[model samples]
Target: MSSRRTLIRGGHVLTIDPSIPDLPVGDVLIEGNVIQAVGPNLQVADAEVVDAKGMVVCPGFVDTHRHTWQTQLRTVASDYTLSDYGLNIRLGYSSFYEPQDAFLGNYAGALEALNAGVTTIVDHCHILNSPEHADEALRGLREAGGRAVWCYGLFPNPKHHPFRFDDFDPSWRLDDARRIRKGALASDDGPVYMGLAPAEVEKPAFEAVAEEVRFGREIGAKVISCHVAMGGHSVHVRPSVTTNLGRALLLGPDILLVHGNSLSRHELGMVRDHGAAISATPEIEVQMGMGRPILGAALRAGAKIGLGVDIVSNIGGDMFHPMRSALVEERGADNDVLFKNDQIPRRLEFRCRDVLRVATMGGAEAIGLDSKIGSLTPGKKADVICVRRTSFNTMGAWDPEATLVHYATPNDVDSVWVDGRAIKRNGALLGVQQPSIVEQVWASRERLERQYREINIDQLRSTKGYQRENYGN
Candidate 1:
C-alpha cells in the first residue's frame, strides 16, 4: 500500500520525548522512512491504517551488543563456565559452522527479536574467520528484515586461548571493515547499519587497539565498542589499573565501552568527560558473576548509558527480562532513599522508564545513532514496536507503564516496523518464515555438533585453563 503514509491509529503512545511529554491517546503518521506527524489525530485521509487500538506504541528496542549467531547454540554452553563455555561451545563448534549455517542462525535470531518486538539490534559479529563468513552474516542479518547494525569484529569470541591482538591482521581488518560499510552500510537498505567492534580491549596491545579505534573514527564509524566491563579471567587476577584506565584516557566521543564495571571514580569521570557511552548487560553480569554494578557507577560519572543483551546465549536476549532485571536488581540494592542519594538521585529514585530510555534512546546514543533512530521524533526513522496491551501478559493493568516493565513478555509484541517497513506483523515475520529459518539454524547446529564430535571436543577438556573457574568461582 502506502509506504510513505502509514497511519498507526489509536494507541496510548509513549513517545519517549520530553518536549511532547506523553501522548497518552495518540496516533503516529509515518511517511517513508520518517514519522510525518504524531498527535491524537488530524485526518484519516489516503493513509493505509494499522489499527493500534489496544497497543503501547513506543520507539523500538535497541540491543547494543548481541552475538546473533549463537541463537542456534543456546543453552548448549549452559553448564560450561565462561572459560569452558568458549572452549567447548563457541570455538569448539561455532568455528566449524559453515557460512550458510551462520546465515541461518542470524536469520533465526533476527526474526526471534522481531517477533519479540525489538526493531533494531547491534549484532556484534566477531567470528569473521573468513571474508565469506562476514558477508554471510551480513546477508542473514539484512535479509532477516529488521533494523540491525552489523558490527564486524576482529576476534571471534574465544572459547579457548586468547583469540588476542596478534592473531588478526589490523590492516586486513580495516579494509574489511571499510568494505563492509562501503558495500553493505552505504546501501540505501532497510533496518541494517554497519560498524566495527574492536573485539577485546585488554588483551590487545594498547597501540594496536588504539589504531583500530582511530581507523573506525576516520571512516565515520560513529561507534567504537569494546568488551571492557566483564572482569575476564585475566582481569580478575593481575588486575589492570593502567590499561583499564589508560583505554578510557585514549577514548573519544564516538567510543562505547560495554560492561564497564571495574572503573574507579576517576576512571568513570574520564569516560564521562569523553562523552562516551556504556553498554551494560544486566542479566549476563549476574550469570557470569561479573557483579551487577554499572547502573550506579556510569550514572554517577555522568556518562551516557545503555543496556544490552550482551549475547543472546542467556536471559540477555529479551528486552523484557533485561529491563525488569536491571531495575529490580538496582532498586533491591539501593533499598531506601538514603541509598538512592548515595548511588542514584533521590529525585528520580532509579526509575524503570529511565532504564527503558537506556534500552532505546540511550542505546542509540551509545551506537551514535541518536539523530537517525531510537526515539519516535517527527523527523526520525519510524523504527517502532507495538506491545499488545490487550494480551494476557498486560491485561487489567491500571498502570500502563509499570505493567509493561513488570509483566510484558516477548509474545506481547504484535508488530514491528523498521524504517517504514513492517518486519513482524501480528506475531509473525514478513519476508522470512520463522519456522523454516529456525529449522535451518537447528539443522546446521546438529551438523556442526556432529562434526565437532568426530573431529574434536574430546581434547577440549584437556585444554589448559579450560574449567569451571570464574573471576572468583
Candidate 2:
C-alpha cells in the first residue's frame, strides 16, 4: 500500500451512489489507491489539497466497450456503414497492422481515454494478428497507467486472399489467449486485468462459441463479451444469438452483450434474467445502420445497461456522445409514439441523471468492476474526474448532471485520477509523451493506408464484403 493522501476540496460532487447523498460543496479524501472519506468540511493534516471549486467532481466515466487498437484509424469509417466497416477495417486494414502498430494504437488510445476523463475501459482489442501483437497491446495498456479490462479478442485475422472459412483458425489464438491469462493477466487485482471477447455468435458454430466461453471461464476471465443481434443484416444466423446462448445454458452474469438493437422483449428479459448486461454504443449503432439503439428497450426490460464508445474509427472516444445519444434517442422514440397517437407527452421518460448513471455506475457493473471503482464511496478505488462547471457551455446550469449530460465535452475535463494517482491535471494528461505517440501513430496509419490502397476494391468486396453466404452457422 501507498501512504499518499490527497484532498479534493469544495466541489459539487455526484457520488452516483444512492446511499451517499450528493454534496453541493464537498471534499473527497483519498489515501493511496482508495477513497477514505467523502463529505463536507473534511479536514486532515499533511494531505495534499486540490482546489475543485467551480468544478463538478464525480466518479470517472467508465467505457464498457471500445476497440482501443483502432485509435490510429480514427474517423476512417466516419461515413461507412456497418458492412463497409466490416469489409475495410475489420477484414482489410487490420491485416496490415504490425506489432508496433498495435502498441501505438493502444497506448495512444488509453491516454486519449484518460484525457477525456474515462478512467476505466473495456478494451475489446481484436487486432491480435500474432502473439507479438497481443504482447504489444498488453504492454501499451500497462504503460499508459490506466484501469482497463483488456478483453482478448478471439476473432480470426484474415491473412490469405478470398478470406475463406479455411482461414478461420482458433488454435493459435486460443493458445496465445491462455498464455496471456497465465502470464501478465493472471491476477485480477492489477490495474489491468483479463476479459474475453469471443467471436460473434453468428459467425461461428454454436459449439465453437460455447467452448470459447468455457475456456474463458476456465482461465478465470472477468467478463465474457460478444456482439449480438446488431441487426441490419449483422446477424446471419437464425433463432437469435441470445436464444442460442440461453438454450445452451451459456448465459450468465459474466456475459456482456453489445448492440442488441434487434433483440425482442423476450430476449431482453432473458438477458436480465441471466444477470447479463447490455452495452449500448448509441452513436455508432445509429450511424452504422444497426437499427435504433436498444437503450430504452433494455431499460424497460430492467437489464443492466451501460454506455460505450464502440470504436473511435467512426465516432469520438468520449462518453458524452453515447450518453446524450442514448437519452435523446430514447426520448425521441417515446415522443414519436405519442405523436402518432395524437397525444401530448406528459414528461421525458429518460433523464440526464439516468444516462450519467449508465456512463459510470452502470458501465462498471456491466464490466464486473462496480465493487471496486464505480461510485464515490469510501473503500472503493479513487477513480475520479473534475469537470469544469464554470466553462462557457456549462455555466449557470442548475443541475450539474444536466450540464454534464448536455454540455460538457472532453475539453471541459479539468482533472482525472485513477487508483488515487492523478493521470490528468489542469486540463492535460500527465506522464504522457503525446507528441511522440501522435507522430508514431501517424506513421503507422500511413503504412496501413498504403497497404490498404494497394488491395483491389473489387476483389476485397467479392472476397470479404459480400461473401457471407460461405460462412455457415
Candidate 3:
C-alpha cells in the first residue's frame, strides 16, 4: 500500500456506477490505493491535493483484448487481410521474436495504454515461443505498472515457413500453466495477473479446446479469453466451431470471447445465458472484413460487451477510436435494418454514453473486475483519468459523454492514475524513460526486419485475390 494520500478536487466526475450520481463539481478522496470518499467536499489532512477544475473525471478505460506484443510491429499489418495476418504476422514474424523483443513490445504497449487513459488491459500475448518469452512478457507487464491480465496464449501456428511449427501438447501446456500459476502468480492478486488464451474450438479436434480451457479453470486463471467466430480468410472460412464443440463446455463467467463476427444470434444467446462476455474490436473486425463489429448483436442478445483495440499492428492503440467506431457501426447497422423496408428509423437505439459504458464499466464486467476498478465509487481502486474538456478538439463540451466518445483523443488526457498512483501527469507519463524504451523497440524491430528480409510482400498481397474468389465478397 502507498503511504501517500491524494485528493482530486472539483471536477465533473462520471462514476459509471449507477449508485453514484454524476457530479458536476465533486471531490474524490484517495487514501493509499483505495478511494475513501467521493462527494461535494471531502476534507482529509496530509493529502497531496490535485486541482481538477475544468477537467472531466471518469473511470479509466479497460481494453478487453489486445495483441500487445505486436506493438513493435505497429501498422505492419495495416492493409493485411485475415489470412494475411495469420500467415505473415502470426506465423511469420512472431517466429523470430526473442524474449527481449517481447519485453520491448509489452512494456511499450502497456505504457501506451496508460498514456491513453486505458488503466487496464487483457493482453493476448500469443507469442509464447518459449518459457523465457513468457517470463519476459510478464515482466514487461509488471514493469509497465498497469492493471492487466497477461493471457498466456496456447494457439499453434502451423504455417510459419523456414521453421517447423509444432503444437503445444495439452499436458505440456497445462503443466507450464500450473508452473506459472504457482511460481510467478502465486499471490493471484496484483496489478498484473495470469489469464489463459487457449486455442478456440474453431480448431479441429474439439477435445483439445476443452482440455486447455479446463486446465485454465483448474489453474484458477482470473480470465480465459479466445478468438472466436472470426471468418474472412480463404484457408478455413466456415465460421467458428463453437457450435461443433457442443454447448456443454462454453458456459462460464470467466470466459471472454473476442471478435465473434460470425456468431449467429442464437450462439450469442448461449454466451449471454452462460454469463460470458464478448470483446468487440470494431476497428480491426470491420477493416479486415472479419464481419461487422458484433457489439450490436451482443447487446441485442443481452450479453455483456467490451471494446478492444485487437491488433495495434493494424489500428490505433487508443480506446477513443474503438468507442467511436462501435457507436457509429451500431448506429449504421440499426439504420440499415430500418431502411430496408423504406421506413426511416425513428430514433437512435444507442447513445454516446452507451459506448462509453462498453469502454469502461462493461470492460470491467467482461474481465470480472467490475467491483474493483471500473468506477469512481468510494471503495473502488483509484483507476481514474482526467480529460481536458476545454481542449481544442473538445472545446464547448455540450454533452460531456459525447465529447468523450466523439471528440476527446489521447492528447486531451491530462492525468491518469492506476491504483491511486499517478502514472501520467499533465499529459506526460511519470517515471518512465521514454527515449530508452523507444530505442529498445526500434532496435528489436530493426533486428527482426534485417533477419527476415526475404519475406515477399508481393507474394503476400497476391493472396487477396484467392481470398476474394474462394471466400466471395
Candidate topping TM-score: 2
User: What is the TM-score ranking, best to worst?
Assistant: 2, 3, 1
**Number of the predicted model whose lDDT against the real structure is largest:** 2
Q: Residues 1-473, candidate 3: write the lDDT tens digits.
A: 54788888898888888989988899888887888888987878899988988788999999999999998898789998776786678756887788999988999999999999999999998887777888899899888889998888876543334344333343455567677899998776678878999854455455667777787888888889978787644126343455543365655888888888888888888788888888999988987887898898788789987999999888878899999999999999999887898889888989998999889999999999988988888988889899988777988986779989999999899999999899999899999999999898889988877755666645544554323323443
**lDDT (CA) per prediction:** 0.72, 0.88, 0.82
Query: What lDDT tens digits, residue by residue, belong to model 2 across residues 1-473?
Result: 55999999999999999999999999999999999999998989989999999789999999988999999998799999877888888888998889998998999998888888999989998999899999999999989888999999988767735445355666898899999998999888968989999976677677888898888888888888888787856556677768888888888888889888899999999999998898899998999878899988888889998899998898889888889899999999999999999998898978999899999999998888889988999999999999997778888876899988999998999999999999999998887877888789889999999988887766767763237622452
Structural similarity to truth (TM-score) of each candidate = 0.88, 0.96, 0.92
After superposition, the stretches of candidate 2 with alpha carbons farther than 4 Å from their true spots are 160-168, 464-466, 469-473
Query: Roughly what TM-score does model 3 have, to 2 decimal places?
Result: 0.92
lDDT of 1 by residue, 317-358 (tens): 678777888897788766654565675544547787777887
Off by over 4 Å in 1: 1-3, 156-171, 187-190, 232-249, 336-348, 455-473
User: What is the lDDT, from 0 to 100, of the residue 280 in candidate 3?
Assistant: 92
**Candidates by lDDT, descending order:** 2, 3, 1
Go through the candidates in order and give the clash count of each: 6, 0, 0
Better lDDT candidate (2, 3): 2
Please report the TM-score between candidate 1 and the true structure: 0.88
The residue pairs that clash in candidate 3, if any, are none
